[model samples]
Target: MGHDHAHGAGGNRRRLGVALAIIAVVLVAEVVGAAVSGSLALLADAGHVASDIVGLVVALVASTIALRPATDRHTFGFQRVEVLGALVNGAILVVVAVGVAIEGVRRLLAPEETHVAGLPLLVVAAGGLLANVAALLVLRGGDRQSLNLRGAYLEAMGDLLGSAAAVIAGVVILTTGFAPADAIASLVVAALILPRAAALIRDVVRVLTESAPRDTDVEQIRAHLLDTPGVVAVHDVHVWAITSSAPVFTAHVECDPEVFEEGRTGPLLDELGECLQGHFDVTHSTFQLEPAGHVDRGESSHR
Candidate 1:
């Protein structure tokens, strides 16, 4: 297929390291501000920043682990660590968002007194906004096709929005002495976190469960294989992702006996491999060339 795939995550790991540092600094600042001002919105924003810190840390570790070389005992060489990290990040975000939502609702009911020093809150939130923007830009140039990097970027974007919300809520409370505004802002931050967390979790589950690539149609693949000359049937076809960008496939292709007799299996195998790689972005595939009714005879079927 002539596609040159970039295999390592070294550059991405460096970027993630930088982003993690920025998030750690901002998270601490937000926590202190939340405590001093007793601002629900600021506290919620701090929680989001904490999530980003965790997400970035996971991304950095996964990226580093992903660069390890393959060994006989671990043939894939820890690449799947990226997917696992993404899953863990997703789960944590959901839990944290739920906690924020509950706190926000409770504050809305009772209206906690917010001694929001508006100018300081604004300054801190603005600084957080700037930091998150910087982190996002740093991660933007990395291999976002990887789920790990994508998760980091998404978390940073969410933190940026949360910071903006905190700034607006701070100004509102300062001007009107309205305490509910802080709670409302916290609710908004929680809403922003939920959908992205759910989506990330779904994607991670798909990969872990060995579901087919979202864009590849199994029926279409079967038809394409059947279209090849000397092929009689296709069975036990399966396609799945090993990571966000890496897909693995295996199938049993039944062909005429004469094709095997004539030592034509090599050319046929090459043609099938090229077809899969070019059409469906499947570079790793295993095909069992067999005579018709191979499955009926108790040949193993992965499907």
Candidate 2:
């Protein structure tokens, strides 16, 4: 499991690196464009792109750290670093969204003070949209499988929407001379960012709190374990993750006394392991095969 996780992290790291490069290029262009055009929409998109760069950097570093081998002191190695990176990305997204929204509302209140050059904004926004598209494609494959990658992908998606909003605002200003369109577009970008940020943070919090992976059904897992031959009951069944893909499960399985005394323990363990891996996609599992009547001193206190 560790080997497979490290391998996947390697691929994710490479993807993050490529996406980071793409976003970095667009970020510079957008920043300059925002300054030249004095367009709030362009500035908002530029700010989102900047956040994407930061997210990708965090994800990239986390993936690299996750490649490290487990040691005695850190048995899980650095897999949780990916979750931390995702949390940071989520916080950054919220900050950028709120900041952009506040400034956008301020600008909306005084449209006459907004002197955005529509032509420059349009050209830059169009370019930014294309770059965002490229970055999204680079991140698309791994987003569902890794929370860290998903955070980066979500940032890119936000950047894409922001660029699109900027483009629309530019067009409205160019054709109708509506200066407030830029502020409206910035608000739209903020609106797009908030939901995605909320979702990422929610997922990160679940992992930090050691909650089971969302796709996993704990009751079903317990039932499955109980259905194993010779297994009478399963208790203290715990499921959680170090990251999105690295789920871990542990349980105390009560079984018939003959199952342990008659040399059947090995096969039972094999069957349990295979069941978890095959049905639940849980590669790391630990089972304590206890005799049916045996008891641990403090077992009643456990769940």
Candidate 3:
């Protein structure tokens, strides 16, 4: 499992690097086109692409930090760094969207003579769309369960839609003298950004807060442990994720004294671990197997 996780992390890093490079290249073209065409929509899309560049950088750094080995000083190593990065990236998206929206609204109210070169705007936006599609394909195969990767994917996805909108706005501006089309497209891009950014922030916040894995049921876990042959009760049952895909569990189990006497506690513990792994997808677990009434004898250890 550890080896597989490491391999997956390496793949995610490579994908991020590729996507980042692609976005950086396209960003320059979009910026130049926006300046030359004086298209608000194109500029808004460029802003989003810029934010994606920042998001990718943060995701890459966090992915690297998350691979660090655990040490005494940091018991869980730097695994949570990815979650933090996701949160920061999400926040950046929201801020960028807001700024673009404000500018779009201003443009809509006070129409300006945008000397847009329609063909250039269309070609540039189409090129951006193609680049975004390539970046999306690179990130699509990454671990979707990872918040860090998901956040980056969300930004790329938003930019993809924004680029499409820019193409439409450019076409409309060229065919008809509709200057507000550019502002309208910028508004559309902002709309695409808001919800995805909010969701990414919520998910990362849940992880940073150490909430239980979304699929885990504490009551069900307790019941399963109680149904074990030697377990009489289950207490202090806690389940939380160390990373998006890594759930950790620790519990205290009251067991039949006869099982310990007969030297069967080891087998009982093995069964418990297997049950958790098979039924709950919880591979990392620590259980304190105590004979019935042992909790009363060691009050300090109960927790």
Candidate 4:
């Protein structure tokens, strides 16, 4: 398990490096294109790429931090730090989107003249889009389960859309020297960014606040464990993420007072852990084995 964990971290770190390089290249290209064409769409893409750079840097740092040993000061270690970093990335993404939206609106209000025709715009815009797509493909696997990578991946995804919007706008400007199309396209890119930023913020907020996973119901978990073999009742249940990939659960399990004292509680706790792992993917568990009727049932754990 330890070796596998080390390998995963190493792999993620390597991928993060690659992604960051790609974003750096894209940012420079997009900013130059924005300057040349005076297109808000190009500038908005630069902003998205900026977020990607920050997100990837955060991810790399978090990945390195997570590999550190669990010290007494941090009992659960730095796993959740990754989640916190991701939360910050999410918030930053939303802020970037707002800024981009403002730029788009400004562009809409005062359209800028651009010699938008031909090769320079298309070449840079296509390069940015291709870079974003490559980054997305690089980080694709981990995005589903890892919030840190997801934030980065989402940034890349957002960049892809934003870049494509810029490309379309550039093409339109090239065909007909109408500068308003660039601003309109930037508005469309900002709209795309809005929902993604909101959703990432919500998910990361839930994790940082220790909210239960949406798919796992605390009541249902308690009820299921109560029906397990040799279990008198269950209470004081707590379930939350240690990171995007790791969830921890702690609960007080009421077993028969006599049977639990000696080693009887071990197997029961094992079973409960197994059940939790199977059903909820909770990887760490702490059970406070208690006697029956010890605590009132209604006062279990926090809901």
C-alpha TM-score for every candidate: 0.89, 0.96, 0.93, 0.89
Tell me the tens digit of each residue's lDDT in model 1 across 8-33: 47777878888888988898898887
> Candidates ranked by lDDT, best first?
2, 3, 1, 4
Best by TM-score: 2
Question: Which residue pairs overlap in candidate 1's backbone?
Answer: none
Report residue 163 deviation for candidate 3 (angstroms). 0.4
Stretches of candidate 3 exceeding 4 Å from the true structure: 113-115, 296-303
Tens digit per residue, CA lDDT, model 2, 1-303: 777888889999999999899989898998887787665566667767777788789989988988999899999899999999999899988998998899889998887777888999999989989998999999998998789999999889988888888889889989999889888888988888899999999999999999999999999998888898899988878899989888999989999989978999999999999999999999999999999966677775666
**Using lDDT as the measure, which candidate wins?**
2
lDDT (tens digit, per residue) of candidate 3 on 1-303: 566567777778888999999999889998898788675556667777888899899999998888877899998777788888888889988997898789778888888645556777889999999999999999995647688898889888878888888789879978996878878888888888899899888878778788887778888988888898878888777788878878899988888889889999788888999999999988889988887876555444534
- Local error of candidate 4 at residue 96 (angstroms): 1.8
Model 4: lDDT equals 0.76
lDDT of 4 by residue, 1-303 (tens): 346556776777787888888889888887887788675456656766877688779888987887786789987667776777777778877877787778767877876533344456677888988988898888889777678778877778878887787778778777887777766776787788779878877888788888887666888889878888778877677888767677668888878777666777778878888888787777678888878878755764443
Q: CA lDDT, every prediction?
A: 0.80, 0.88, 0.83, 0.76
lDDT of 1: 0.80
